[model samples]
Every structure is written in C-alpha cells, then in structure tokens.
Target chain A: MGITDETLKRRLDGFRKRMRDKEIDMALLVEPDNQYYVSGFRAISYSRPIICLVYLNSLQFILPELEKDHASQSARTDELYVYHEIACHRGKDTQFHRPLEHLLDRQPASSTIGVEVDTLPAALYCMLHERNFIVKDMGPDLMEMRMKKDQEEIHWIKQAGVLSDLALESSLHHVQPGISELELDSFGDKKLLEAASQQFPDQLIGFADWTCSGITRSFMPHLASSTRKLEKNDVVVHSRQVWVNHYRAENERTFLIGRPSNEQKYCLELAIEAQAQAMQVVKPGVCAKDIDLAAYHVFEKHGYGEHVQHRTGHGLGLTEHEEPYLRFDNELQLEEGMVYTIEPGIYVPGVGGFRHSDTVIVTNNGFESVTQYPRSLEDMIL
Target chain B: MGITDETLKRRLDGFRKRMRDKEIDMALLVEPDNQYYVSGFRAISYSRPIICLVYLNSLQFILPELEKDHASQSARTDELYVYHEIACHRGKDTQFHRPLEHLLDRQPASSTIGVEVDTLPAALYCMLHERNFIVKDMGPDLMEMRMKKDQEEIHWIKQAGVLSDLALESSLHHVQPGISELELDSFGDKKLLEAASQQFPDQLIGFADWTCSGITRSFMPHLASSTRKLEKNDVVVHSRQVWVNHYRAENERTFLIGRPSNEQKYCLELAIEAQAQAMQVVKPGVCAKDIDLAAYHVFEKHGYGEHVQHRTGHGLGLTEHEEPYLRFDNELQLEEGMVYTIEPGIYVPGVGGFRHSDTVIVTNNGFESVTQYPRSLEDMIL
Candidate 1:
C-alpha cells in the first residue's frame, strides 16, 4: 500500500487535462474507484453518499459527519465538507442535495459540472439540474485516464498476484474427489490468509472470496460453489483473487477431479493454446479487440467456436474490471502500463468447461505475466 | 436456506399495500438490499445495472445477459429481460435506457412510478423522466416498509448471530500478549470459515470482513486492523459478521487484553450500562431518539458525554446499516418487528475505546436480543 501524495498529484494532473479537453469546469465524482484514483482517500460510499469535487487545481471531499475522522486520516485533499450541519427538516438530509448545492455555490455559479451520471443517483442529478448548472457525462475522458496503470498501482497488483498464486496453490492441494467445491474454496481462501499474518503481519490487504465449480457446473463461467461433491473426470474451474489496497489480480484455472477424458483434455489444451496464441500478439500499439480475435480464431480452427463464452480477457486494476475490455469490436488500442487478464474459455454442455487466466502487464517491448501461475493441463490434475 | 416462493409472495403483497396507499402505479427497485428483499434474486449490480420493476400483480427483472441463468434461478419473476446476446458488439446493448423504455411502454406512458431515487443513478433516472413517466420518491414508503423484519428474515438474523458468537469466542481464545490486531482478526475469520462447509454444506454464506482495533486505534471505531500487537492493557474492539443468503447480522465486543486499568474498566462498564439502559426502553411506541437519549443520559451522568461519537445504533437487515438510525434527533417511533443494534460507546483517544453492541428485535412487551454474545467485562478478559 505504497500510495503517495505524489501519485495522487499525478492522477489529478491527468484529470485536469481531461477536464480541459472536455470543457468541464468541475467534476462531481461519486464512484469509489474514480474517487480513489483522483484522491488517495477511499472509504465506503455504499450506505451513504460521499462525493469528491475536482477542479483544475483543487480537490474537495464531501462525506457524512460520521466519516470525518476517517477522511482526515486518509484523504489527501485539503477542502472537506459534511452534510447534516446545514438546513434539515425532520433531522434527515435527503439526497445530500442541500450540501451539494452549497458546495457548488462555492465555485463559479455557472460551472459546467462533469458528473458520473452512470453511478450518481438521478435525484441528485435533478438537484444539480434544478440549480441550472450545465451538466455533462465524465465518460471517455475519465475512463481513458484510468486505462493506464501507474507504477504504484502495478506494484500493488503484483503483490496481489503473489497472494493469488498462494491461493491457487492451496486450491490445487485440496481438489480431491470427495471434497465439495466450497470446501476447496475455503481451503484456498484460508491457506493464503493463514500465510498473510506471518508474511505481511500488519497489512490489511483483503482476500477476495472465490469458488470452484465441479462437473458440468463448470460450464457456467461465474458459477457459485455447490454442495455437490467432485467426481472423477469432473472439470473443476476455480479462481484465486486478492486486492492490495483495492488494486486486484486474478489467477483462474480449470482443474480435473481425477484423470481427464480425451474431450476434457482437448478442451483444456485448446484453451491453454488459445490463451498462449492470443497473448503472443499482446504489446503496445495492438487493438484491444484483436487480442480476443486471436483466441477466437484458435477455437474456430479447432471447430469449437460456439463454445467460446466470454471475451478473451478484461482490463484489471483498482476495480476487478476496468476499461479497454477485450471484446471483439472494441477499437481501443493497448498501451504500455496497461494491465489485463488474458483468459480464453470454452464450455460444452456435456463435456466440461476449460479456461485459464493470468494477469499480464503490457510493457515497452512485449507483455510481462505478473501472475504466472501454471495453466498446463498435466500440472492441474488433482 | 429454506427460501421459498411464499416469502417472496408475502413481501410482494406488502409492497402492493404500500404502493396502493401511496397511489404509485409501479415501482423501480435498484438498491441491492431493497431488490433482494422484494425478489428472491440476488446478483452483483456493481459494474452493471440490474433493475426490478414491480407492478400491481407482477414482478419484472432486467439484467445483463451474462446473468440470465442466475436471474432464472434466483428471481421469482418470469418477465426477465437480458440486455446483450451471446455475441459481442453486434449484440451489445449500451445502458438499460431502451430496455427500461420498453418495459415502461407496456404500461401507460404517464404511469405514476415510484423509484428508489436515493440510490438510482442519475443516468437511469433521466431515461425514466425522458419517457414522460410521473416519478415519485420511494423514501418514506420504502423505509417504513423495510423497517419491520419478517419471521424468515429474523430467522436468518438469529442464525447469523450463532456464527457471530463462534467468531467472538475464537477471537477471545486468540487474544494473546503479542498478537497483532490483524493476526487476531484472521484467527477468528479462519476459525469460523474452517467450519462453514461442514455445518452448512449447501450454503454459500459469505462472511463480512472484520478487524481488531487495538489500544488507541479502538478510539477510531472503524479503524482498519494495524500491525500493533496486543499489550497488557489494550482494549480491542472486534466484530464478526455473516450474510446468510442476503440477510446480515453482526456482533461486536470490546475486549480487555491480559489486564485492565481503572479507566479502562470504568469506560467498559459505562458503555455496557449505557447499552443496557438503551435496550430497556426499546419497545413499541418508543421514539427512536429516546433510545439514544437513554444511553446519552448514562454517559452524561458519568461525565463522558463528549466521548460519544456516532448514533446509538442503526436498523439492521439485508444491509449492515439501514433505516431508523438511533440518532438524537430522529423522531421515528419503534414498532414491533423492528430490529436494530443497541451500541453505546465512549472513545477516549489517549486511553482506549469501549463499546458493546447487540442485535435485538422489538417485542410486544419490550425486546428480545437476537445476538446474545457475551459482552460481560469478566468474560472479555483474555
């Protein structure tokens, strides 16, 4: 968690450039990840509204009265405001409307505000509209700014990757025939967590919950753990995840309960090969979607094209999924300092599901696998 | 675990009663807890938008195509709409703007719609307003309805209580002289999770993360677990939480390590007495604020009034903190079936913080404590 004020300053400078291009005088940020990116402060905004107003040269955080102490401890911003101290009717401040208006009044009255419309509540939007402030969506400019990872973010992601590997190794050790998917998941979760206190000791980095889907249940990409016990030839799809101060990394694998059937082997090998082939072309100046095409072409050549379910991969950073999603038609180009998960999956109803994912970072020359956990079929046999 | 259609039916009927009283033709639910309370469906809506539309006699669910199978399994509604097709950009649907408009088109264009305006994003609200629908806030109507806990929900809360006690007991055993706060949190976390698969073999209940805030850190109630190791006179505030399906419950304790100073013992006793006094008045027909006053009176009598930080407690159910926040100015009356935490605290930064919380349901005569984890000063000594 080596987040520094300098890093926050760098991100703020990037936002200012984007704001200048978008002609937004001020930004009303509500998204947790977005706020964390602009300011070093990150607190819960799920139960209540916590906003950050970003001007070209200043950062202001507005939060509930209860969280004032937390903001003071974590927020790098100097200007802070709390609601409920102002006008209230029945001791309830509805929508933080008055507080938001009061903050907006501090700036130029006609400031063109850039709001995260996708996440900000509509009632709050109406309040801003009622005040006659020109509003615009903080879309491409904001998303593009977050697309590239910083050295600090990459460092956290790498640390998370180490934890991910530990979790995966624990899952590999527990994938027995009689064990339930949930039982195996707990083994991995506890295994890594048990090591955390001994290793990091004081660090509060959190282990993301994970699950394994045994048998045909593995065909579903995001299957929850089941009470169903693993059987021989069952394809067990399991994943390990960890977040170091909100920067996350994932290492997913498709393992066999016992000996793999020929069909299962075929699916697993193709997935592995497809991932290898897809990643071979990953580097700066590459189209994000073309990376997906590389994997799809492999599946199609093997006559299991319809079995491809999700995209080749998704960008990974502070949030689990970020911009430059490796979907088929995304025209965004991959850039250096961008980190992504390169996963190619194929699922057949009766046979089984096969997929392997690794976290990789685009480098100056090529791509570096940050989470290089083994994805080989023979190595994954339980 | 025995969630059934009857539970959903009962909740829907209750919503119908409120909708009729409020003259709202239909309701759009977005808050995860609110949607889960009404429909059996519970899926991630973090990165994507998943909406629930409740009409007079029907329930409709709209979600991303990736969650179609999940919606089918968990949602009681038959009118499910998935945005994207199995393919990529060719079938990609942007926001639910079109899907929402289509759903609204089935009703009167000017139909009066009740919305969770506090949580609904501004972008989605604009779509509804743009469609010429009469929009109204579902605040008072919704909060009042959710305030009361159903028997099934109460059952889940009680079950969560059992797990909480287990976690507290484990933490009590692990609070040694030199263990770091995070190390202690992990000890309890692992101990509880280690037994999850065996006890509830079919359940996928996830535990909410908790930590031990040792010594001076305890004064900051929500302080993240640090590297600080336990000392002879440290006061450790630790909480345990479990979510059964979507219902959540918490049990928190302030433990005295090895030995306690006179100040520590005094603060601990005052906090315990304050909570006892607060719960003594928690019955039907009592003002929510009065319960807070009961605690305040004790703290004031003890000359520790300024030490009190947050509200006495908040209503608990699907989410951690809910309606009927026990603040000094809240005028809402307590009613039977309303469940809440009764926690009173004294935080002296230089010394330590002391707080004990219990989840209880208002009964006909008074209240019954659901989370009866031992918070006695003698039992807390490690």
Candidate 2:
C-alpha cells in the first residue's frame, strides 16, 4: 500500500500550522519530493514544470495536461489546473504561466507567499517579486518536517533496504575479472526487479546503481557504472539505492577482486571499522556531528585522515540525499524515527576506495539497521 | 571515446561569443547538461551544489571535496576550488557559497553576470542580486547551441538510438500475460547492458524505461513502471530512453498483450500515422508548429482531436526534453542537425494511450530516423 490518507492529513495539517505561524497566505512548492510529501503525486520526469500550491485550508496542483489523470488519481488536492500543449486546446490554458498567473490574481496583492528558495526557479521568483508579493523561504520548514520519517515511510524504506541486500548479493555472486561495471549492475537490476515484482505486486519500485572499478576510477567516489571490464586485483566501489513507493535505502560495498596487496585489505578493513563506529553512535538525542567525528577519528587514528573526503553519511527517504546530513559541521540532534545511511569512506590515490553503506533507523533508544548485507573484509573478497 | 577536446573548445567559444555579445563578464551554469556541454564534466549525483563558472578567458569549478578528483580528471577548467565538510578542513571554504562569494569578490561591483534563469535557484539569484550586479539569462543561449547537435554529439546519439532499439526488441520479446511491467523492463535492461558492454568497451551507457500496462495506467502518459502484472487484452505503452556519453535517444512502442479490441487497434494505428506525419515534416527551415500540426491533423481527421493532451514531440539530446518543442504555440524554425522525438499520442478515457516514439535527426532537406523499431499494428501485437 502507498502512503495512508491519515498520514497525508497529518502532514498537511502540520504544514498549514507552520504557514500560519509564519503568516504566509500561500506556499508554492516546486521541489518534487516536498510536493510528494504533501500531495501524493509524482511524475517520472519534470522537464515540464509541476507546481503544488498550499494554503491555510486547501491545496492545489498546476500540472501539464498529460498528468491530469495520474494526478487526479493519486494527489489529494482541492483543485487541479492543467495547462495543455495540444492545438485543439489553444483557447484554454496553453502555458503553465497562464494558469499560475490566474491563481496569483485571486490572492491578495500584498499577501505573503512561501516558496522553496533553494529549488524555485529564478524566473518564477522574479515573477512573484515583480507582482508585489511578499516571499519567504519555506524550504527549511519542509526539510525539518521531512527529516523525521513516519511509520508508513519507514515501512517502505525497510522494504527497500531488504530488497537492496538481495540485489547486492546477486551482483556480487556474478562478480568476475572479465565482467564490465555496467554488466555487474545489470545482474543486480534483474534480480531486484524480478524479486520486487514477485513480492510487491502493483507497488512502484525503482533503483539506481554506480560501480566504480580499478584504482583510478574507484579513487573518485561518484562515477557512473561504465563498460570498463573489472581487472584482477581491482578494488570496486558498488553503490546501490532502491526505492519502494518513493522511499529510498542506500546500500554500498567495496570488494576486492583477486587482491594481493596487504594495503588494500587494510584500507577495506579500516572503512568497515569507520562505518561501524558511525553506526554505533546513532541514538536519539545524539548530535549528528558526533557520528561523523566518531567515524573520522577511526580513519584519523589509522593515519588516513586526509584521505577522508565526504561526510559520514546522508539522510535517505524520498530523495537520494536529504537534509540533516551526518557531517562534521552539522549539530542537529538525532531524533527517533530519523533514518540515515552509515557510510564512512576513505580514498587512497594508488590504492583503491573502500566504503560500506547500510541504512538504519533511529529507534527509541538506539538504532536498527535495515540493510543486513555482509560487509566484512572476508566476505567482500571476490 | 568521450567528448573530443576540439568539440569542447568549439562549444566554449560559441558560449563565450554569446556572453561577449551581451557584455556579460561571467556565466554561471547550474544545469547539469549545460555544464557537461561546456566543461565535459558530470557528477552522478548533485545533492551538493556543483557550480561551473565560465569567464571570457577561463573556466572555474566550485564543488564539494568529494568531487575534487573526479572533476579534475574530467572537467576542462583553469581552477578548482573545493569546499569541505570534514571538521579538520574547517576555517577553509566550508560551504559552497563561501567559495562562490570569494570568486564574486574579485569582480567589479557593476560586473554583469549571466545565469540560467529557468533553472538557477532563487536563493542564488537573490545572492547575485544583493551583490549589486546585473544578471541576464543565458539559458536560451545554451538551449540554442544544444538544439543543433554537433557531429560528435550525433555520433553518440546514434549509438544511443541503436541501443534503445535493441533494448525495446528485447522487452517486446519477453512481453506476455502475467509478466509484470517492471519485469518486462528488466529483460530489456539485461539485454541492453550486456550488449552495450560488449559493443562499447570503456564507455558510459545508461537507460530508463517506463512500461504503463493495462487501461488505467496507460491513460496517463508518464508513470514509472510498476509491478502490476499484465493481463489478457491489456494495452501497454513501453517507453525506453538510452544515453551514451550523455547523449540520449528515446524509443517507445504501444503494444497489445493478448486479443485487444478493434478500437484499440485503430487507436494504435492512428498514433503510428500521426508519428509518421510528424516525422515527414521534419526538415530544415520548417517551423516547429508545422510538425505538431501535421500530427494533430491526423487525430482530428480521425475524430480524436479532443483526446490529444500533450504536444506532438519534444527535442531530445543531452536532456530528456529540451527547447524548440513541437507544440502548436511554438513557432521556432527547425534547423539542420536538430534531434527530436516524434511521438504524437492520444488518450481515450475508456480506452487506452497509444503512441510510438522515434528519435529523428533533421538533415539538409529531410530527416533521418535513428530509432527504427517496428511500429506496424501487426508488429506491435505481442
């Protein structure tokens, strides 16, 4: 099942309370995840703009005509204003701006409007400014609200994590010296899709994977899976994120293929230790920085401090990387129901990058890991 | 091979010329495709802001610490300023805006800056505005440049088209009753990845597929593939896009699973005719509206004018949908080397959606079809 109507109602009520506190007459949401949180509608692509407007009492959607039926079925909204592209509908709303302008005209000229400052387009912001409307950033409010996952969201994320582990197992089982990175990812894709189909009929599921192999490619963290064949003794960083009903879980593992170097084994073990340390610090009321620092100290103690490049981990939910990051600078307190990935990594120049990522949920006192894939150095060697 | 250095130089020179003509001191590119076109660099994920600044004589990148090595190897830039998240790197450029501000401080207060108004975040735009600098839109300039594919770009797009066709054929081969939509997509994915790995070694290849099976889901044009099993007499619209080295080609086919209704067959044939009519009108110097209208007339003559919801097609290249769309209101003239997807579809309330998409390249006089998947009613009947 998708998100419950009761959960959606509670979320909308909370957002309206926030808007009232800020004395905002309207909140224009352009970020897809934020919109999906309030209204249960999402499109595969957003090359054509889709707007969600929330007021004190009701919500509205301004989308393309192509999404009319889909939004009507999924979105719990008060009104939908569709803009058409077909010639026969020329006399109607042909452009999104036309309907948007009409909606704005209905509101008071001096009304305060809230917008996602980080995602709202400059052109739209300029239009609101030129119209003499008071605009404030509601992006932070939405981020703060979405940081804590509800029970329904957690359920899907847990399912995604379980599915991810299965997919990772299938991919590793097919790992060999001659297989290309893309082919390696494909093996997992087939297993994940087939398993998801069998288990969760009628549910929407999606995934993204990145396999960076060899010393040169794996040293850089974020590279797409390519057609380069994996060589003997190559260190490969395989990252997979699976989303069930839009909630995501990230799972990553660094494995050694025919490795002979003692340094490579040491680095992989260090990464596993760092990830464990970070996961150990995940508890309610703990500072986000503490987790990062805990993992950082592991690498620093091993004389690999400079090799650490990114944060320990990032929050995972509707989007790939959400707010409340486990970074050294972040001081946000961990709360119950908050979900994040415990992934701390180090990349050495001549050696290879090593990291193990697992999704975990913060419970009343401690944290519970959703992904249970084997990540020990012995298990990682292929 | 990836993008050649000569192509990068030519693209940069063209963009700089546009900036010089506008008297803009610098152009800040935030869109991933635009950045890739100019700098030949792209990150797998951009949750952390990646800013590319192009000046009259030089190019600079301000990115997260994780992307330092990746960007260095790929981006053709003069300088790289990285912002860190780890605590040890504090007091250095800790946030993206800090480095961005440092770069801005070097320019004169009255210096003009160019930005992608359609995609630049409102917060960034406000920051630029508060700095007492004049900002102009360079998004259109980038779109205009990207509209006409270069020879090297076309080569990759062709490769993408070939891969897309092969993938579609694989999916269609596995189409049968009781198979889930996602399972259908996975079959194609497996075939595509294996073939791409064999054919294009050491290259980057990616794909996205959406299979909207049955009446209700098919009525909506854009929906992610689900785990809903196909039933007898189901109407399925299978859409796939394959990208090689960042260039994309879209391929789609609407097929019948078992014994479809006569109305379904007629609708499918009408969609095929509409697409053919639109593709036939794709010549240099022709207006974009003419192609859309040519497709629209096919449905109108067949008494399904009101059923059309979206435009005939959209430009396809680095982005899924780009400028110079095939819409009735858009009167932009088509040019040689322009690539577009000719997909003219109609969705009936009680029936289903019918559309066949093919990527085509505008030639000196006519057009060349890149995605040549079979579209006949007989060929589509599974």
TM-scores for the candidates: 0.93, 0.99
Residue pairs in clash, model 2 = none
Q: All models: lDDT? A: 0.77, 0.93
Q: On residues A248-341, what C-alpha lDDT tens digit does candidate 2 reach at each position?
A: 9999999999854899999999999999888888899999999999999999998999999999988889988887799998889999999988
lDDT accuracy of residue B222 in candidate 1: 69
The numbered model that scores best in TM-score is 2
| Clash pairs for candidate 1 | A122-B122
Put down candidate 2 lDDT per residue, B1-382, tens digits, no spaces: 5678998999999999999999999999999889999999998655799999999999999999999998888899999999999988987988899989989988898999999999999999998999999999999999999999999999999999999999999999998899899999998999999999999999999999999999999999999999999999999999999999989999999999778999999999999999988888889999999999999999999999999988988898999999669999898999999999899999998899999999999999999999998899999898
TM-score of chain B of 1: 0.93
What would you estimate as the lDDT of candidate 2?
A: 0.93
